[model samples]
Target: MSALTIYKREVSSYFAQPTAYAIIVIFLLIVMSLTFTFGGFIPAGDASLASQFFAWHPWVFMFLAPAVGMKLWTDEQRNGTLELLGTFPLSTRSAIIGKFLAAATVWFAALLLTFPIVITVNYLGDPDNGTIISGYLGSFLVCCTFLAITMLVSACTRDQVVCLIVSVAVCFVMVVGGFDPVTTVLSRSVSEGLAEAATAAFVWDHFSTLTRGLFRLQDLIWFGSIIVVCLLGTSAILSAKRS
Candidate 1:
């Protein structure tokens, strides 16, 4: 079987169940609610999504992305289907990438649904289109990053709840580690070089950079490196289990 075959199967299975729909609804509710209420979308008087809209993406993805990905490998393992899947003609890497892409497609659809917000901003004010697009790109990358982390965690366990909890915890650290308040507190005690290194390794700086409409090569490298490392780790764990 090709990766495309596995991708189509996983995507079909996701939409066949209510899991994908529920997550998309919850994500929309939380993000839109926060955007208007706490995020001060209107009150901020900011034309760009950087401050009031995209700012909340990392926090939202820190939980929901893992929730969406928790079942990727955990369900197969729990239902004793992992071994059966391994017997397929496809490589373990193909299965991993297919499932990951399927999860990403669900989130991509959810993000696309938020286009009305784009229309609203455009109608209300002349926001920079390039910046808005960059913010959306950054938000999607944030979700993918969490999903990749969850894939690795899900491969290590059979229980979906355990996968969810561990994945969220790992994502939380990455988000919090780059937060200004947390960094400020730590920077006071730690050396500046160490604090800078920690921030660079985490998600906030790179994500914020993109949200600001600045697509740096290093930002792409950071997100890509973490994602590639996690997916490879998932492959290794599954391979060991299959053997």
Candidate 2:
């Protein structure tokens, strides 16, 4: 009936299933391994873990966030509970916000678990804590954006698998929109302004700004705008179902 109640229920549901546990474990393993092995945080002469850690977040969230968010509305629709939920005193906007916050909480917990890496970096060398802090902020914002997109996609379908696939595709494009491969291909046939615009559309652009320990207002606004728009779209879809 209240936002807190909805938040608690959604968070509880995530932990109740094995999927959430599996995702968290896999996420940590992949991120840690990549950071040390490939990112060369251990052997590349840089004592700071920020490079290895933040570098993997965008890729990790591309898949893991969708895994967490795919069931938000799809499962309710599949099990015929969405209709009941719409009848509650809670507005659609509140329900969407509550669910988004719940999913974001899970992501925050996942990010917090990586603090040992942060501690390890501090133990090894005089790493910039400011950069590490900014990295966490960037990572969380990226996850929120991904989750919002997945939530909107989940609302569009009763099949969670379909939702997951569609969300992944959409998130992937957003992640690579700034990559050289993507931008290069676009540049060959498009105007420079158009190519730049394409590259600017990805989360990677805004995330890079934060990862540099520079808290740019525009980057925060961009990520926040995406979250708001996607969640608002999700609420609209659910409201249509209710009507």
Candidate 3:
């Protein structure tokens, strides 16, 4: 039928399963607790929410995002529903876009559930709403990028566990590319340009900028490009299967 119909169906499928709710609840609890405890939101003597919220994103997404996205296509393929989906009247591109948007919506809901932290920050001290907004934007973009990567990997296999593991491995490298420990080691052995390029390829560098309330066009482009490339690759794979 229509793209919206597919989108609704996919979104409904996720909500119908208790696993999605469990994942969201568990992820939120872990992130919120870590942000308050390790990130020093309360003990750092600073009212800024940056440390508490943004600090945990890379690590949290390392597992949670992939867990959410691992089933996108893999489950369909496992159930032999993907081929049936192909027989529908909608174009492959529309189906892909619809499914992607549905997954993004689930992620958006997970992000939205963290608003209590936003409220707590606002209540405690003068935090910049602008910066918090930008942080959310950047975090959501990173989630989209991770989800797109997971979707691509999910499309490649019928086993959700395999999809999850592959997605996690891919996402881990991207996250580590921006980590200080990894970058420092790289800078020692490689040129500064190579090190910087590695950092630039991941979500950390761009996300850090956004968390600081600076929304650079290049950062936006980097995240957007990754999503586009992954989704296109996924579409190509599916199209080949149809042929």
Candidate 4:
């Protein structure tokens, strides 16, 4: 419906310039380089592409996905078009969904651009293709999660730079909140259960669960819920702005 219309327009705008394409290329190059250097694909002696490829996705998307989504609404407001967009027949939620999908599609295209990594893994060893596929799925979900968070931040500001900084800060917190240092501090000051709960609430925990090819319904639910919540938050913010 109207969401589709906005989705089409958003997607078109991304490709109208070389920005999306350049981002995809740079993303692939950086991640792939990190895989070989930091991930130790060959030195680790792992048959699966786990550490080599998928391990860096969460960190990569932390910045890249925000870059993709930061301008979704900020640009509209900056150019004095958000009000015009609001007057359209489309619902606010629909517009939010459309913009989210558009940003998600750009990330999907980025994932596809790295097909050669899959091919390389195949050539190097008889890897578990099923696990590899699941990793891709998990990475996509994480990318969309970043986009949704970015959209929420973007909706609150017309300054794209502010949107980008705030998005990155939020994302960095979500990433580190699950790491040992944060959890360790939480455990010392708080109950162990509270520490565990805090760690579980972070995006990295859910993302790691899915990336390991553990398709738990709960992990999927966690990611899906984050996406929905962020989209609703964006819509609510935009509605207030419109009024």
Candidate 5:
């Protein structure tokens, strides 16, 4: 009935299956390969993990976050557990928060597993550990946002494939909405003030700023608002369905 009960169950469910481990392994391997091979982390010869390493996180997260979250509710529904869980004496809001915390934990663990990269950077030279920490925090927020979006979509569907595709599509738009061309097009069609505001609304704007080690309240608010809104929407969706 308590949020803690649901949180513990949700998190335990992840380890109860091999799927979570597979996702973590795939994420570490691909991210490391890109960091060393394509990202030119070493050849760049820079102490910062900025553009060379964390730069690829949005793309990496676009796929993997959905993989982790696509089943959050879709599987519950498919297995007839959604309704059963609803009758467990907890509010839908508790379920939403518990699920989000659970997903975020998996993501944070996956991020932690990439510490060898951190070790490499430290070994090579004295990099700004503060900046590195901020970058990881920003990436964690990104994962949470994506998971929130995925959870919302999963709440809307019982088919995991549909949930995955919709979540990916939404996440993709959020990522690309910050690109130069997209911003340019919006600026041309909309009033300059509105266009600028719209472009700033994209994930890339705030996320990139944090990656650069600049901690602004505005950036934190942007991600915080998205996380809260999406998770709330998820709760609403489940509540409506239950009623």
Candidate 6:
């Protein structure tokens, strides 16, 4: 089978269930609630959503993205389909990429549904459209990063609940490792240098730059590196298991 065939199957499987719709609705509710309430979008009188709407994406995706991806491999293993998948006329890498793209597509649809917020921001004030686009791109990347991390974890186990817990824990670290509160606490308990290193490793450090419309090359590289590494790791683990 071609990668396209696998991709189509995965995509069909996602929309066939209520899982995709539920995730999309939950994501919208969480993001919208945070933007209006805790984010103070109205009181701040900001036209841009970078600080409010988009800023919450990493935290939200840390949990939700894993939920969406936890089944990618875990389900296959749980249902004894991994061996069936192995018999297909496709490379493990093709299956991996196909499945990853399918999960990414689900998040893409979810992100698109958030356009009402964009409309609201435009109605309230004149916002920089370029910055807003950057924010969306950043949000999507963060979600993809979490999804990739979850994919890696899912490959290691058949239990979906175990996969979800470990994935969320890893994503949580990525989201908060560089957070001001986290870094401040780390600095006191360890060498300032170690704390700085932790901050550098944080997904936040890379993701926040894009939300601000500062497309630094290094930030892009960092995100790309993480996603690629996790996917490659997943492929390696699956290959070993199949052999």
Q: What is the TM-score (0 to 1) of candidate 6?
A: 0.97
lDDT of 1 by residue, 1-243 (tens): 578887898899989999899999999999999999999999888889898889999999999999899999999999988878888787889999999999999999999999988999999999999999999998999899999999999999999999999999999999999888877877899778777887898999999999999999999888889999999999999988867
What digit string (tens of lDDT, one per residue) describes model 5 on residues 95-132? Answer: 88888899889999999999988898899999999999
Estimate every model's Cα lDDT from 0 to 1: 0.92, 0.87, 0.86, 0.87, 0.89, 0.91
**CA error at residue 37 for candidate 5, angstroms:** 1.9
lDDT tens digits by residue: candidate 4, 1-243: 999999999999999988799889889889989998999887877767766788798888888888999999999999998878878787888888888899899999999888987897788778888888988998999889889999999999999999999999898888888877788998999879988997789877777766677788988998899999998898889888767
Model 1, position 155: C-alpha lDDT score = 95
Residue pairs with clashing backbones, model 2: none
| Root mean square deviation (Cα) for candidate 1 | 1.0
Q: Ten-residue segment with the worst summed lDDT in candidate 1?
A: 190-199
lDDT of 6 by residue, 1-243 (tens): 577888899999999999999999999999999999999989999887888888899999999999999999999999999888899778888899999999999999999999998998898899999999998888898889999999999999999999999999999999888887888888998879978888789988777788888898887888889999999999999999867
Residue 144 C-alpha lDDT in model 1: 92
Better of 2 and 5 by lDDT: 5
What is candidate 2's lDDT per residue for 59-162, written digit by digit as tens? 98999999999999998899998878777787888888889999999998888888788888888888888887898899999999999999999999999899
Error of 4 at 130 (Å): 1.1
Instruction: Give lDDT: candidate 3, residue 112.
Output: 93
TM-score: model 3 vs. ground truth: 0.96
Q: Which numbered prediction scores highest in TM-score against the true structure?
A: 1
* Over 4 Å off, model 4: 188-190
RMSD of 6: 1.2
- For model 2 the TM-score comes to 0.95
Candidate 5: worst-modelled 10 consecutive residues by lDDT: 190-199
